[model samples]
Target: MKKSAAYWIWTICLAPLIFLAVVWQKLPGRVPMHYNINGEADRYGSKNELLVLIGILFAVNIGTYLLLSNIHRIDPKKKYTAENLPVMKRFAFIITFFMTALSCFIIHTTLHAGSGFNGKFVVALIGLMIAALGNYMYNIKPNYFAGFRLPWTLESEENWKYTHRLAGRIWFVGGLVLTVLAFFLSEKAGFNVLMIITAIIVVVPTVYSYRFYKQNLNK
Candidate 1:
């Protein structure tokens, strides 16, 4: 069959959502689409609220893709051809798609009770590891919006350079730790661990960026 040119690609990004949609139908109890049932069972929520949540997520994905796709200037000064751009874009699309799928998987698995030990979150966790591997394999240079973005990493050329190098190492280690956590930890513990990891990832680079900025100022 003729496919969606972007087929399987961007679609992969939404696989978790599709899984949820399907699982929602298949599961014994009725799971609301928008609002999560919270800490209660056999409970339903306002449809409006549920739609809003989905809307927000939809917006986030579209916005994130747009922001990531266009942020880097294609080294305009270098001679490049249009033919190569699509393939290059596809690579990026794949990376981003995987990131989204992974994220949603993690969210879905963590939030629901019967989702088995590792449901979608484990998939997301795996996707993230693959992403890290891809980043290393492609030697894909980091940009402001891609792969371990931090203000310190983007503030200045030097900061950006040092930050990504640091970030790459951080993400690699973090991904590894999280991957193990995904397998062994209880779901609650796993989510807590993920949040802690995310916090460290966000806070560390931000603090480092400020320090780097100050040092540069002094120099």
Candidate 2:
């Protein structure tokens, strides 16, 4: 991993922890820790519990970073490791950043439990992350740990390339639509849209890959 990327990852991973430490005294003894699908706080717990949750999230971020950074070393295929290293590192940073931002968002919400859940913001953030992944999805080589990883995509390089190329465009557009809808629709409507789009993005690529494989087999 590049020194700069590693530095940012650490900084991001620790941001929520630092924030919680600073605001520990200000938080109420009981805080809302979970929200329902309708974006209402349905669970409450002690502030101490929030600390434990954040700590666990931070550890998960570190674990994820380490895994992504060394994924190529563990995979049997070594031919594309050097070429894909940068993409992997960039993705690591992106994941770290997203997780950090999400942690911080949760902390902020915890502090203002009365504000209700900001489903739109959460959905928008998720959409943005998906868009980012889609933007780089085309660059990902066939690997066990990432990308589509379907049997068809893994067995044929052509299938992998074409499937991802089509997937990238579909995901990018779908992500943007989700982001836009998050703000305009009610919480329930937005949730429904998110699910539908998620299904489309995942299923389309899988079905396309299978059909592409069959066509190639017939050829």
Candidate No. with top TM-score: 2
Tens digits of per-residue lDDT, candidate 2, 106-187, equal: 9999888888989898888888888888888888888888888999999998999999998989888898989998999988
Q: Candidate 1 residues 24-49, lDDT tens each?
A: 54443433332222322334454344
| TM-scores for every candidate against the unseen true structure | 0.57, 0.97
Clashing pairs in 2: none
Top of the candidates by lDDT: 2
Model 2, position 115, has a per-residue lDDT of 87
Over 4 Å off, model 1: 1-5, 13-29, 32-42, 45-63, 72-155
Model 1, position 46, has a per-residue lDDT of 45
Off by over 4 Å in 2: none
